[model samples]
Target: MIVAATPADYADRPLYAPIAPMLRRFPDGLPDLATLQRLLEASAPQAVSGGGRPVRFVPPDDALPAYEARIHASGEVPTRAGDWHDFFNALAWCVWPLAKSACNALHVRELAAREAAGLPGRGSRRDALTQFDECGIVVVTTDAEIPALLAAHAWEAVFWQRRAALRETTRFLVFGHGSWDQLRQPFFGLCAKAIHRVVDPAWLRLPAAERQTETDAWLAAQLAATLPTLTPRAFSPLPLLGIPGVTPDSEQADYYRDTRQFRPRRA
Candidate 1:
């Protein structure tokens, strides 16, 4: 049984490192909808959803349209009070507004296409998008070989053999808010769908905030261009625990040998 985490647990884990700055604002508990909206307005005044509506968090409304549609149409994110999932999602909007907006746009576009085509269900593109939204990690690197190793599922080779290089040349940024929620009580088999971006090594040297800004811009452009062609297969699977420093067990080379989490790639 998953015990929902409280604000007190926010700073206790490395998994929350990415969003620590934002999480610090509400140390007592989850922020209410008004607080979230104020944060959005202050932090990302220009932030808007796909349909150009200004992004604002509001209480959940059953009478509204579907979640994505509502966001696209009205930019109102239906946030459940005190819900960790919704809280992190709100943080994602503040941190990666461009990419998040692009994602919302793509979702609206895909849904419209499906309706026009008389499709009965959400198609593969939407499925891929949701998977990424819920559990995606963006692996930014200067080295192409590193992504190749990840794609090959060469856990030992990538996380152990080239560990130093991996640290120097690559950065793993968690993009999925659901993954953030899961990381509150991280488990062995927690894997994330990964998308790779090859960036200049110099870009990696910038401060965290600057790097995130660039990443948001680049990712938004990438998604705007390729979302139509994206499939779940386009992502590489990454065992979060296998990353160096994510867990104490990962310090030793033997940790990568656990096939349960580091399954070998099928031929």
Candidate 2:
């Protein structure tokens, strides 16, 4: 079982250690644009094209128009203005290439579908969903009861009453750029929130520390193993605080209350 390293030990830990296996050939320090591009090419050669042209992730000066065009064209995710944030975002893209692509595709598909059905614009649902897509984690569980609890909005039962089941069956997959960076200095507001998905009948039985490392490693390997073959999931991204008994005025209250997209299972 892996032991939790002290904060002092974290000083020497590699920032990109989570996805090190996928980006196996990068240099030993913080990556520049060239280093990042090489890492991306090494991890997913199909994702990087246009030779020297800035296509996927560009600076905000170019990103504004790119984002606007992408809203219509579903091309690529726009990069933010800052250096560090954009770099983290690029790494997130590398880590969750398929999911990221799926998210972009869904955005385009939903827009077209809505227009064709004579439905109104996305308004706030699309915006909220995009925020979660950009900075959310997906928690997949193998236990049947946990999902039942989640569906019923039985927060106390899932999180507290059956806490062991939650620990034993959960696989937390990080997909957001902000969530990736927050791993360095995690806090309440920027704490890890997840989209719950149920998996097949299999359980993760491991010590806490070992489980954490194994989960990261497993996610990295999964990304490498299933890229072009990945299928879209019916992911419902909600905040940790949104769990029924966790908070009264949850940040995602409106999102959870909305029946159009998220149908809360009332029991």
Candidate 3:
């Protein structure tokens, strides 16, 4: 029977499947921006060295410069922060607070260093890191060889031929909602490739209790030095099957098979 599906049928599709596991941490699933705001308001103030500040969500009306300044000064990632673009950022922080803190702290230091050095403005590294913090992918791997393959853009080897190895060796942690949305309706030609930072696999092998501490230390070290370099590796064809919970047929796959976006590097 070729019955047409309705909107209600598609409603079951998860909006942000990449973070479905992390979303479970909330117990209450992902809350809307308004609901998230009320919850933050109800929470107790964060204890600071000099007393504490009551935690509150940054209103959508706040100017961007002001919001950035507040976070930079306070070293706090606001809950339900910013608008639709950054709502996923709040969720990311909830999922990986240590990592998010490490990222923010690094950015602040980079900005300060630039000011101290009398650099004209933001450095390339800072801009790159900021792009990463806004919408980056952390590819944590157990094997040393995987990173090289990733850097080389060996999509087939890393994602297909050695697919089983990927499940065992790599962990993809997505941070930005922009990244999340792209994963949902991926298009090879869109040029929306994520910023990739590969975490050493050895860190993951540590005891669960020590993993966060070790990872935080690693992040801090990387920040103190150079931020990870980003490269574009948009899939030649969107890897729909590779994505969890996405079961697109050939027709659906055709959507991302556009030659404009998926043009081969070799003529």
- Tens digits of per-residue lDDT for model 2 on 1-267? 122232222333333334545433433434556666666666555552212122265434552543533534533445553344566677755665545554555455555566898999674434544665556666667876766676565554565566566656765556666654554554333333355556654335544334444444454454334433432333333444433333344334343554433344444
Please, what are the lDDT tens digits per residue for candidate 1 over residues 206-255?
99888888898988898778876898888899999898877788988888
lDDT of 3 at 115: 86
For residue 59, what is the lDDT in candidate 1?
91
Q: Which stretches in model 1 have alpha-carbon errors above 4 Å?
A: 1-9
What are the per-residue Cα lDDT tens digits for candidate 3 across 22-112?
3443443345665554433432122111112222345444544434445656534454433434555655544444555555555666667
Model 2 misplaced regions, further than 4 Å: 1-29, 48-55, 62-68, 71-82, 111-125, 151-156, 189-193, 202-267
Give the clash count for each candidate. Answer: 0, 0, 1
Choose 1 or 3, whichever is better by TM-score.
Answer: 1
RMSD of each: 2.0, 9.5, 6.8
RMSD of 2: 9.5
Per-residue error (Å), model 1, residue 157: 1.0
Note the residue pairs that clash in candidate 1.
Answer: none
